[model samples]
Each structure stands twice: as structure tokens, then as C-alpha cells.
Target: IFCSQYMSWTRNYGVQGTIFPAPNFNPVADAQMLAGALQGFGCDKDTLVAVLTQRSTAQRLTIAEAYQSVLGRDLIGDLREKLSDHFKDVMVGLMYPPPSYDAHELWHAMKGAGTEENCLIDILASRTNGEIFQMREAYYLQYGSNLQEDIYSETSGHFRDTLMNLVQGTREEGYTDPAMAAQDAMVLWEACQQKTGEHKTMLQMILCNKSYQQLWLVFQEFQNISGQDIVDAINECYDGYFQELLVAIVLCVRDKPAYFAYRLYSAIHDFGFHNKTVIRILIARSEIDLMTIRKRYKERYGKSLFHDIKNFASGHYEKALLAICAGDAEDY
Candidate 1:
């Protein structure tokens, strides 16, 4: 139902971004200002938001360095000390690099007895080969252990296999060729349509191995031949999380912004506040295409994401999120 409706829709992935590196950036000066803001009784949260949200992560890193060198204090540590509750989540999130933050999410996902398999699917399915590679590096560097090893131990069955393939970053790249695209489309059609029993091995190979650009072409070709969206067929054939995960991959390939828009919607409206989800999506996409996402969220949900956060949140947490959501929607 969902994937079919979005099949014809496409979003420009990199056309818009919300956050940018602050102009005339003086990390030392900003660091001193932040220190001053935090020194007194009630923190000047407005100044904190103004300085932190407007600056890019690299700028934040420099500010952290300056804060350390100048005040001989950890910037994130002080922010943690000064801020509490939901707001602190946002501010502390700003201190981490994207992949480093992603590694943190993965660690949390698999930390306890149970696991959030959907989190595994979200990161592995949506990210690029280079991004996956970088996240693996960052995960190892940050956590002092291998991501693949963790996934192997934490998850089982074909689901683990599916995630491992995405983590492997083995998708074929380069411009799409009509000949290969046609062949791949036929392979998928036969594997899903003509055949009966679970062909997940064949399915995973085709879905994970092809470039997204080529897969889009194959999805079109599959529709032309079968008169059915591949995602619809997958839904009919498979059930449960694996089906949902495959659909997510297709949705991401078709329109990544829409995929994330759906994610943001679920995170917000899914039975109270899933703060973890909110923090990850906002922080990771803030510097990327959060503007596009905000626009899409308004179009789809008929409300402002900023307004939703405002209504559902309060205190410094709300202030911090509003700072992130209120960013200029212009190219840097």
C-alpha cells in the first residue's frame, strides 16, 4: 500500500540542507561565550542554541577543542552538566560526528538482552557503501570492536545475513546499463513471481548487489513486465520484519527523503515520544537535507514538525530541538 503509492514519487536527495557552518566562525570566541553562558545560575540557553545549532559539526569540533585548550574543560561534559532531560540529548548529539553518532545508535540498539532489528535495517538499508564503510570504521574506532562482529552475535537467521550483505558494501556501482538492468529485472521477477517458496537468498543477492540507480531502473522494468510494483510483490510474498525491511530498502532507493519523512513521522507519533529516534534523525539529517525533510513532512502530515516538537516538548530540550528545527533552509 505505502510503497506502491510512493513508487511514482521521487525526491531530490541533496537539493536542500538546513544547517551550515557558521559565518566568520571563531571557535575560541564561541567557546568563551558558551562558557560564560554556562557559568552563572540559569544557563543562557538562547545563546547556547544560537551558537551551537548555527555552526556545523566541524565548527562544533573546533569549538570543543578551543573550549578544552582555553578553559581546560570538556565542552560536552559541561553541556551535560548544565543541561538536563530531552534538551541535553540534542545538545550532546551536536558534539558527535555523524558516523560516530551512528555508531552510538548501533551500540544502543544491540546493547541489552533484546535488539532493535529495525534499527539495524534502517542504518544498513538506507546508508551508502561509503557511509557503511565509514560507520564500520567509526564503530570500531569508537567502541573498540567490530560492527560486523556485533551484528553477527546479536542477530540470527537470514535477517543477520541481509544486514551483513548491506554492511559488506558490495553493491555494484556506476551508471545503469539497460542490458544488465533488464536481466536483473527478469531475475527478480522470476525469483518472486514465477517461483513459490522463500527465495530470500536470491532476493538478497539481487536487491543488495545492484546499485540504487540500476535498481530503480530494474524496479521500473519489473513493473512494465509484471504490471506490479516489486515492493507490492515482496509484501505479498514475505511477511513480518523482513518484508518491512525490504520495503524500507525499496522506499529508500525510490526516494530517500520520503523514507526519512516516514521515519520521522513514526518516531514522533508512535505511542508517545521515542526520544532516541528523534535525536538520531534530527542530528544526522540536520546538516544534510533536513530542510527537504521538513518540507516533505509538512506536505505529507499537514503540520509543521517544529510545531509538533514545540507542542510535545518543553524546557531546554524543546529549546534545543526548536533551534535545530528552525535552521535556515538555504544552501551553505
Candidate 2:
């Protein structure tokens, strides 16, 4: 039951009616607003050590500007003096331009004898549409080479094609119609029941091809006709790695944040922790939908995500993850 609406208000009024007055402000006031927020959050010299270290480079600049205006101090200089080790390194990395992040990731993957497929997957798959477009442009601008060409050279087959397609921003445009969505779901179910290659193809087509908004409608129609949630149906029908792959696609399509919440829960629920998965999911989604993930985590699990993460994991990694998940990743 999602309801969306756009609201508009006009400040001017004619005749005898009273007009709503606009709030007054100045540049100093704007600075105070940002500064007050950081101060209110207790983001002082010591706290900036953690904040700057954990956030991305773009995030640090915003904070630094705010700190300079409000506190009459330099955030980066303070952080340099107070922090050290891995934390300092992360903070310094966050200060680089976005191009630097992409180039650095690529450099790390290609620096040695071979390319890291996981790094390629993590970056290309997780970026938003606009971010990926910007990255493609930036990659060309920074390296004087085609980003897609580099990715193709590093990988092969359908997986490579899929990554490149995503990076190239070539997917179906958004579509929405209750009737067509129901038909698509029926077709999907029939293919799934038959255990044909069409099932996998359709799954990928719907999951990877459609916009999230359109897929949400399709998923709802699927639920109506199938009398079961898509996740449950996929879990029941598929097996082994195929099942995991299908489930990941469906979950990601359904609600990415919810998918992440489940992943976070899975990371620590079993006897031993899948630390890599935890770290990967946290880092990948930290700036994407992590606040939404926290909301979904609370709703689905009936517990504060930070509290659970603290209970399950330990040390600075846990703290960094929690801070990022707490909506401190970046201003953008």
C-alpha cells in the first residue's frame, strides 16, 4: 500500500486572504544549520576522526566546509592530527574526487598480474543509474580508455555481458500496466514450472531489465496470481546455486534494502559469521539504501539493526558499519 503525492504551496495571496510568510535566512545561518547539526550529533574533533574516516571523500569535503564555516577550524587538518592507521587511510581516500575512487578501484583490481572479478562486480553492479553514467564518463575522462572495454577484457561470457550492459546503461525502459504485469507473471510462472531455460532467461529479463518501479508492480501482480510471494515460490522451486541466484535476483528486485536486511541477518544468525558477506554487503549498500535497510531490518526482525550488529560483530569494523548504516555515509 504505497501512496505517493507531490505537494506545492504558494507564498503570495491576493485579495483579503492572508499569505504564508517565507522564513528569513542568510549564508551564515545556512552555515549554522549545518554546523549545528554536526555539533548536535557531537561530531567534534574526536568524532570527526570516526566520521571523516568512515564517509566517502565527497562527504568529507561537505563536512570540512561546514566545519570551517561553523567552528572556524579545518576538518581535514584536525582529522590528520587526531586519527591514524587504517581509519586515517580511509578518511584520506574519502577526500579524493569521485573519479579517483573509480580509478583507484580499477587500479587495485588491475595493478598486479590479474584483474579482480569481484571488484568489478562490486562496483559495476552496485552503482545507481546516474552514478554509473557519471562513472562511465569519468572513467573515460580520467583513464582515456573505455570503461566497458576494460571490463570486457577482465571478464567473459554472460556475466561479463550483463555487467557491461549495466555499465553501459542499456536496459528496458520503465513500463507499468496491471494487465501486462499479470501476463508477464503468468508467463514467468509457467516457465518456472516447466524447468526450461526460458525460466532463467525470463527471470534475468525481468530482474535486470525492468526498472525497480515497474518490477514492484509486476511483483504485486505475481503475488495476486500465484497466491504466494515471489521469494517463497523461488525458494521452493529452485535448487542449489540456481536457487541462490534466482533468490538474489528476486530479493533485489523486490526491495533492495529488504534483501540487504536479510543478508545482514544471515551473516550472524548461524553459528559462525560470514564476515566477508557482511563486510561486502555493508560497504556496497552503505551509501545506497542503508538507511532504508535499517528500517526494513527493524520491521522484519523486530530489533534495532545497530544493536544486533553490535551484538553479533565486534571492534572498529562494527562501529564503522553502524555509523555508515546510521545515515552518515555522505551528503549526496
Candidate 3:
């Protein structure tokens, strides 16, 4: 149900991020400004949003350190106490180191009653091997639990198996074999064609272990062999979270920024407004490919992410998200 059009823009994004290090940045000055903003009667929500959202994540961490050293106050803690609602959520998400943030989100997703399978699939499928490694380590350090084990416990059947395979983070990187792509595509087609028993293991092995580049090739080969898009085949073959995760991987392999752009659009329109999903994507991708995401959103949806967000959200929450988005559609 998602667009699979791989754009030329996805191939080359050398710093296509909306957020960047502020020119002439001074962490101490930013920390002090934040301190003053939060000092008096009530809090200066505007200054808090301005300083935190404008800075890069690394710069925000530095400001946090400075806030702790110079003022003996934790920046995140102060912000949490001062800000409220989704605005606070965005500010707090910014303060975390990326892996920590991912780990935190993962833990949050799986913690309570029903698990957030989409959140799990989103992070695990999109991250690189190194990023997955760091997130695993952070998950252990922060929560004192194995991420794979928790996910395995939370999920079951082939879905659990596929997630476990991705958790290994051993997908080949920067390498693709044309011959193997053809072979894997045949394997996938046969597995899908099988009518009896569970071919889920075979499908998961190929889908989860292949490098994204190789998977892209496999997808092309699959099309040539089966005369059907792999995504359509999966939709026809599989069901539930397993199918969703596999499609997500394909989408990311095809075009990560576009996958996230679709995700952003879904978050806005799917329910009333999925603030957590919106906050997570905006904060996580701000320094990665949000600019590309913005462009793709406009191309695919015929409107700017900023414009949709402005209409979906209000008050400080909207202001903070808008800042991270940098500007409207025309800015890109």
C-alpha cells in the first residue's frame, strides 16, 4: 500500500540534513540562555524550543554537558520539568545520543501491554550494521536487558525469527553479487510459490541477511523472474507483522528517505495525528536525510511536511517541529 518509486535523489545525499551545527556555536552561552529561560516564573518555552531545535544533536549533547558543568543542572531534566506535552517530548528526544534514543524508543515500544511492532521494525530494518550494534549495546547498557530476547519474548513465530536475524546485524555491507541476486530471487520466488508448510524461514533469511544494495538487485531480479513486484508478492503471500517488516525493509532498500517520508505522511493522516511517530522521525532523521524526506514528501504527497505538520499540530509543539524541519517546502 506504499509507493515503491526509487528516486535518483536517494542515491546521493552528502549532508542533505535539515538541521546543522549553528554558526559560531557556543554551548555555554546556549546553556546559560536555557538556564535563564527556565529560571523565572514559569518557563521561556520559546527560547527553549529555539535553542534546542536549532542545534545539531551532537551540539545539543555538548550544550547538555555545559549545562551540567556550569550550572550543576541537567539540561534534559530541566527541560522535562519546564516543558510539557509533545513539546517536552521533542526537546527530550533531542538530548539523547542517537543510539540511546533508539534504545530508549525500543524499550518504550516493548515495555507496556501490547508491543509496538512497527517501531521495532522501523528501527531494526533501517539501521546499518554499525548502528544496530550501537543500539544493541545501548539497549543493554540502558535497560539491562537483551534487545533480541525482549523482542523474541514480545513477538512469536516467524516474526520473532525474522527480528532475531536482523538483530544479529550481520547483513553484508557495500557489496552486491549479481549472480547471487539472481539465485536469491529464484529462491524467494519458489518459497513464495510453495503452498504447503512454512517457507517463512527461507524468506526471512534472504530478506533479513542480504545487504540493502544486494536486496535491491534481488528485487529487480525477482521482478524479471516473477513478473511481479516483490512487495506485491509479499503482500499476496504473507500476513501480519512479518509481511509489514519485509515490506518496510524493501521500501528502505528501495529509498530510505522516501520510506520515511511515507511514514511521516502516514503519521499525519493515519489516525488523528501520531505525535510520537512524528516526533521520532523528525528528531532521528533531522541530521540524516530529513531534507530529502521533505523533498520526497512534497513529490509524493503534493504538499510540504512542514505545512501538513503545521495544520496537524499547534502551539509550542508545532513551533518546535517546524524549527527542526528548517522551513516550508520551498526551502528545499
Candidate 4:
């Protein structure tokens, strides 16, 4: 996909001209836009699909209303008629009112007969902090069932628990007081140094529970008290997935870009790359923070992340991932 940059440039300048920026979403205006696109001259189905599917859920609703007012048609019903399964799925995902419903659907998919592991991985592992919270709410609202209960029934062991904890989305809002920040930092330092279960608990609290904004303040406090970067301490004491997880937390805490750079580096370096991990992270973060990941990759690795993936990975899966990483994968 990174190698395709040349092609992207060619498309930008040659035949395609420039891709139009997405319109500022207004439900009423959006209905007009959709009607115009549908009924007006030279409006492409692909363009309509892109615009309708890529907008946030709220924007989609507004556009839906607009679509009816302007075109006298149900946007979703029209979409179903014109688009096939894959595209329809993307559009429908966007059209759904609450994200929690989506989460609930994913949860049920995982628990239903013939479990969809990919859906589980995609939902549980990839959501933003805010999205995860919405999902928890959605699961409860849609099913009147605890998301955690479904997860426990469907998954086993520590990995299951980790996913549940993440979905639960509990975290401190912020640690503004310098004294409190220092105390949390001291606790983090002790945990990293000891590598005990207590350490994991504290690390999870700081990483998974706290907001990134708050964690950053906590990292500074850690540095102030310990005279060492939090990352260095974790690296020294922890090993394997435990270490990788903690490092991810710390990297996310200090610099998300740098953290992703590390992940990108891990994806391609050594004998065989962890393709699943690479694909999972890329897919999960692409919509949420991929632009930031691209920036971080350049700043930390001194080259495009896409370039490295192109150099290292092979085949169609590689191609799909590259397209995704390059920000050209069809929006869903």
C-alpha cells in the first residue's frame, strides 16, 4: 500500500483529479446532497456510498432525514436496493442509532452458534476508549444483559478477562492534583519494579482505566519521582505478552505515535512477523487514530509505516492491510 503511494499521486493528478472533501454533514442539507447525487447529473454511486457510509452515526441520521425530505425515499431502504452485502453492511453499521447496539450485535455474534472470532477480536481489542464505553452501554440496553456475562460464557482464561475489562471501560477521568499524580506515579514505579500481580493491577488502572490525558500527567509525575522513564522500568522487569501489554500502555500513555511505531516495528522486524497482531491493530485503529499513527511512524521510525509493511509483507492479505494502512481502504 505504501508502494502504491506513487499510484495514489498519479490518481490525484492524472485522471481522478482530486478527491472531494466530504461535505460538512447537515441532515437537511445532506438529504439534498444525496438527492442531488442520486438524481442530478454525473453523480456516482461509489461517491454516494462513500459519503453516506463514512459519516458518524449522528451525521448519518441527519443525512437520512435529509434524504427523505429531499428525495422522498428512505436512505437505508434505498441503500439496500442499490448496494450489495459488503457495502450494505458498512452503510447499515453507520445507520444504526446507538453504537452499543453494534457492540451487542458483535457480542451475540461471538456467543452465537459458530462463533465469529474475528468480530470478537475486532470489537473487543480495537475500540477507542470512548467507543468501548458506548458499547458497554449498548450491550446492556439492547439485551438487558451484562456484556461481561456474555463474554465470560463465550471466552475463557485471562485473554477473555482482559477483553471484558477493556469493554467495561472503567477509568479515572483525570489526576489534576500534583500530589495525587505523584502518588499514582509512585504506585506505578513500585509495580513496574516488582513485576507482581499488584503491578499488573496498578498498570491496568493507569493504562486501561485512566484517560490518555490523565495518564500523560501521571507519566510526568513518574519521571519526576523515579528519575527514569516508566517505559524503561517496564522493559527491564516484564517479559513476553505481559511486557508487550505494559509497554503498549506506557507508550500509549507517553506518546501514542511512538507506541504505534513500536508496534509497526514489531510487525515487520525479526524472522516472522505476527500478521494477526499487525492486521488487528491496523484495522482497529485505522478509523480512530490512523492519521496519528502515520505521523507517529514517521517521527519515530524516520520512514513511512506503509513503506516498511510493503517491504516486508507479501500476498493479498498484505495488500489489503497495506491499502488500509495507506488510508485508501474503503471506509466502513
List lDDT for all candidates, in order: 0.81, 0.58, 0.87, 0.61
Ranking by TM-score: 3, 1, 2, 4
Q: Pull out the clashing pairs in model 3.
A: none
TM per candidate comes to: 0.89, 0.60, 0.93, 0.56
In model 3, the runs with Cα more than 4 Å from the true position are 1-13, 195-198, 327-332
As a whole number from 0 to 100, the lDDT of residue 83 in candidate 2 is 55
Q: Is candidate 3 or candidate 4 better by lDDT?
A: 3
Candidate ranking (lDDT, best to worst): 3, 1, 4, 2
**Top-TM-score structure, candidate number:** 3
Query: Where does model 1 exceed 4 Å of error?
Result: 1-14, 40-42, 193-198, 330-332
Per-residue lDDT of 165-217 in model 3, one digit per residue for the tens? Answer: 99999998878999999999998998789933456788888888888889989
**Prediction 3 global C-alpha lDDT:** 0.87
TM-score of 3: 0.93
Model 1 residue 230 CA deviation in Å: 1.9
Clashing pairs in 4: 27-62, 31-66, 31-67, 100-138, 171-209
Per-residue lDDT tens digits of candidate 2, residues 1-332? 01011001211111110111112313344344444434543434334434443444344556567768778976556545555554444444445455456655665565557866545654554455677777777777767877878877876655555566667665455656667777778866765677666666666566566676676887888888888888788777766544555566567666667777787787667636565455555544544456677778889999877787788765555556565566432221
What TM-score quantifies how close candidate 2 is to the native fold? Answer: 0.60
Show how many residue pairs clash in every candidate, following the order shown: 1, 2, 0, 5
Q: For residues 261-297, what per-residue lDDT tens digits would candidate 1 score against the true structure?
A: 8888888898476787777888888876677788888
> Alpha carbon lDDT of residue 331, candidate 3?
58
Candidate 4 C-alpha error for residue 184, in Å: 2.0
Give, for candidate 2, the lowest lDDT window spanning 10 residues. 1-10
